[model samples]
Target chain A: MITAERKPLDEILSYIKPFKRILLLGCNECVTVCAAGGRKEVGVLASGIQMSMLKNGASIEIREHTLERQCDPEYVEELVPIIDSADAVLSMACGCGVQQLATRFKDKPVFPAVNTKFMGGSDRHGVWTERCQGCGDCLLGVTGGICPIAKCAKQLMNGPCGGSVSGVCEIGDEVECAWHLIWERLKALGLTDQYLEIMPAKDWRAGGGSGPRKIVREDLAE
Target chain B: MKTQSNLEKVLSGGHLAVTSECGPPRGASAQTVVDKAKYLEGVVDAVNITDNQTAVVRMSSLAGSVLVKQQGMNPLLQMVTRDRNRLAMQADILGAYALGIDTMLCLSGDHTKFGDHAMAANVHDIDSIQLIQMVKGMRDEGKFQGGAEIKGVVPKMYIGAAANPFADPFELRVMRLAKKIAAGADFIQTQCIFNIEKFEKWMEGVRKMGLHEKCYILAGITPMKSVGAAKYMKNRVPGMDVPQELVDRMSGVAKEDQPAEGIKICLETMERLKEVEGVAGFHIMAIDWEEKVEEIVKQAGLYPRPQV
Candidate 1:
């Protein structure tokens, strides 16, 4: 589950104020698990928006629909009829889904209801934390299971900053130092010696910093 | 006109403040959001727009509160410090304030996996304690974060925090409550309290610790309508206990009387909780059963607490 908090309601409402009828599309994938846009949430947001619009004397028609996975075109295509009738679309999916909808229905406008925060796992039942930055590299072996790119306050690849106090980040005293987490993981895996292996400079190519990155599995190619 | 600054007057003046919370529907449209909030208009003192209440993302609390505000009601934006750093929290707080939401409930939200999203990552960017401290700092220092000063007075929000006395190892729950009060929580709403006897004992302990002197505590009252609901609540809800007595009672009741029985239980709980000292009020969470709240409140004799 990629836990995401909803963006403010006002910002979301403002996006659909001008439209009379809007398609509220929810995704059952990452955004659903993240708590941003799920089927039930779509109901709540759609109903809330409809009531508010009515209260303000704006006649907005809200159609509710949820896709199995919005990131895929197959799921996005299912929303064609739902979106075809609405004035615009207020998608509760991640950025990927929203863009996919926009591309699929170039005539229809698509809006995002959530700000995709990060790629990670739940620390506990209801708390979702950012643990992976999607850096597109494999470095968890040497530094333990933790990824310094995502967990480190400074994204320090080499080691912990001296500013670390009792394993908490100094910049924000509340956060657990990523390096500390890394060290703990190393100790747990008996890979403490691996930390001593000096690594080369990070190659930014994998991270899509240069351009949109692509991965092609040779075996999958026809 | 009671401003946030004049909240003490409002609280002291014996106004039975009515507050309701909204869990954003799981989709993008606002109809469901608006419907719940609109229903709450004449029923609550203010509507609490939960920020992904229970850690499942639906609509943003700030956004939900904004909708409530548009509906001509005061909106208390429930904020969880779990997903955001100080920067994001402060920014969102400022944004919410600018949008006219003056009340904020500071919470350490549910662990992310508990809600609809179980596999999501958690951001312990700042805990509840540090969060209120930051809000208070922003309020008093007139800083817009980055230690820079904002142009006029920064809005002071009515700050509330959560207290779960029913959670296991009750002593730890008490300590957490004390921490929230010390963190500048102006009011406290307890977790869903099914057992008033247990809660009353917890209250006595709370009084002994002098936790009541610092903040106004609101007891949480949830109506359990059926054995199925009870089972789900007990089996699914973490750190929550729906007593077997009530479960047994529901099981014994006729199916038609199940909702009424649940309402009966809620009414009794509220009545009992009122007897607890230092208890300022009750927060009724119908949990999608908002329509029955008025009946529960009315049957509980909470009338004269105006819907306006």
Candidate 2:
């Protein structure tokens, strides 16, 4: 899931200060799972903004709605009827969702309330850790399921660099060395032969190094 | 000989090789490199010029290597994966070879967090192992990493890589060395040896795997200048192992005699490592203390380096 955190209240307020009526949107997808831009968060933000505005001796109208998935065009179109009543659309979803709303409603100003951090999963309650870099090419099978592209600070492929000490990265103590985990896992699984083989230099073109990437599925196209 | 480099000739001639590091100055001072090279010229087989070692910005190792070459010394040009992508690396290899540097060391390099510029983004586009393979391919296959054949005068390099016996997952350190050797590392320069027992144990593994026979393994040595330097490496430096006893030994000595004690300890390590089978030679890393190289080399009985 893509994890995110709500932008500071001041930054969000500054974006919508010029508008009278604002449509506060939410996503039930990744942002919802991370509890950053769920329906509950939308309500919390709306009330916070209203109270803050009232304290400043001003009144503003905020209409709240949480879509099944703000990234999809069909779910975004659900706001067509009520979007006209609002001055601007303030999305509590990830960057993809905000862009979706902006693209769908051509003339409306779309503002993001939460900062999309990374494509990751929750480690525990209130803690999310990145697991993949979407490098397009995956070497997880060889690396014993640990993603070096995302986990290793230097993105080393063969093994850990000289800085890995006591299973910790040079970056910090909290960050465990990804290659250490790989080596341990491979040894336990009796697959040290896989670790012995040298991994080639990565072809980063698939990782969006060339440019923004797009996938076209002719079978699913209309 | 692979590249006809003096280090290669020495190692291939069945003699223990002596290599030492020469860190380029942070500022562009060719004279600094020349000054350091003079101390190491006849005392060592090759001078390992670092490429932005520890991620601090420094003179390009290629340029530093050329300056050392100008002084009639073999410069083991050290290139790190942390700074350059394959394109730039290969270009520099070609450029370095064209300018008369033939031996090179491939390293993953220290993280930028340890350097002055912590905010800099690192480019580990190719890890050190792949880099060794890339250099080998360029030399042996006469082809680029993309498989395009070179039109003329391909870079023929004697490739070297770093090894850390003290790093975690100790069981895999030898295997990692095996991968590097398989990837075409002609020689191996290990991290500094403060913990000799662990290093001997690692060499036992190396001998068990018979990797020592395949590549020349140069033991790294860095003499402590002070007690504070010893403790700092023990606490702050990553992958560095400075046993408490060594630190205690340094502190036990008088303040004025610490540097002498440090060199004495270093010479003792060299004497011990000299007897270890499969131990190729030494890589004395007297960083910023180049003048000490001649004394250290002479005192260790490795002076009057073998003329290959």
Candidate 3:
């Protein structure tokens, strides 16, 4: 799932400081799973902002709303009634959701309350680790399911780039070397011979190189 | 011949070549680089100019290589993918070649977190292998990375890449070397060698795969300055394999004599490595101790580098 983290309280406070009436929006999707922009977080942020403003002797009316998913236009229309009443709309969703909200509610200023991190999942209850790079091409079949593009520091096709020390990446001890993990997985599956095969240079046009990518399905089009 | 570089002439002629490294100064002074090059002038075949080695910002390697060239010594310009994108890298390659640099070492330099600029974003548009292929493409095919044809003569350089035999998943190190060779790396210089036994094992794998026949393999040697240096490399430096016995030996010596003892140990390793098959030469990374390179080369019987 797409992961995100809450922006600093000071930065978020600055965005809403100019507005007398504000709407704190949250998404019930990836941000919620990551404990970043969920319904509970919206309530917590609303109270925190109110407390911060109360200390300054500035009285401001703040409202809270949570959408099923802010990326869809249908779900975004749910905010039509109260959208114009608020001076500004603060979205505690990923960048995509914030952009979608801004596009739909063209008049009101929309600010992103969270920073979208990467496409990853929670490693533990509160910890999240990156799993994929969305490189368009996936090589998990030969790599034993570990994504070197996302995990390896160099994003080496044929790696463990002379910096792998004792199953850890040179970047840090906490991070496991992607190729080391791949080698161990391949060995366990008795596919160690495949480790010698050289992975050719990637066609990065399909990855993050060409430009912003778009996929359209003619079959699903109206 | 792949360029008219002195290092290439020596290696291709089947002579045991010798190279040394010279880290560019942190400040804007070419005097430090020139002085270091003097010590290695007639002592080695080529001098590698490190590019902001360890990610600490320093004088550019291209400018340093030019200084070495001015001193009548061959400079193997080191290029790292950490700081430059493909366009900058390609332009630098052309600039280095135009400045008469004939040898190039491609690396995915040390991470920025290890240097003064910990928050700087790294622009690894290409890894070391792809960088080597890119250089080869420009030299052999006269084309840019995007496949645009060059208008005139392309930069002809002797391509080089680095290998670390001490890193984990040891069995795959040789295969990685093969990948670099297949990517058009004309030669390979390994990380500092302290564990001779481990390096010999890696060499055995290289011999089995016939990699030495494909490209020249120059083992890296760095003489430890003191027991603290040994311990630091063992514990702190990533991918370094400083054996405990060497540290114990250094610890047994007086503080003042540790440098000499370290050189003696390096001399002994070079003598033993001379007999190892597939050992093409030695790359002495004297670090800040460049003055000792001449003495080390002489004592190791590598002085009077064969005139090509």
Q: What are the DockQ scores of the candidates, in order?
A: 0.02, 0.84, 0.60
Q: Which of the two, 2 or 3, has more lDDT?
A: 2
lDDT of 1 at B201: 84
lDDT of 3 by residue, A12-109 (tens): 99898899999999999999999999999999999989999899898788899999999989999999998988999999999999999999988889
In candidate 1 chain B, what residue range of length 10 has the lowest lDDT sum? B1-10
Give i-RMS (Å) per prediction.
15.7, 0.8, 1.7
Give Cα-based local distance difference scores for all models: 0.73, 0.92, 0.91
Q: What is the C-alpha RMSD of each candidate to the true structure, in Å?
A: 18.4, 1.6, 1.6
- Residue-wise lDDT of candidate 2 within B1-308, one digit each (tens)? 77888999999888888999899999989999999889887999999999998899999999999999999999999999988889999999999999999999999888899898899889999999999999999999999998999779989999999999998878888989999999999999999999999999999999999999999999999999889889998998888999999999999999899999999999999999999999899999996788999999988888799988
TM-score of 1: 0.58
Once fitted onto the true fold, the runs of candidate 1 whose alpha carbons sit more than 4 angstroms away are: A1-222, B1-9, B116-119, B144-146, B306-308
- Model 1: TM-score for chain B: 0.92
The candidate, 2 or 3, that scores higher on DockQ is 2
Sorted into a CAPRI-style docking class, model 2 comes out as high
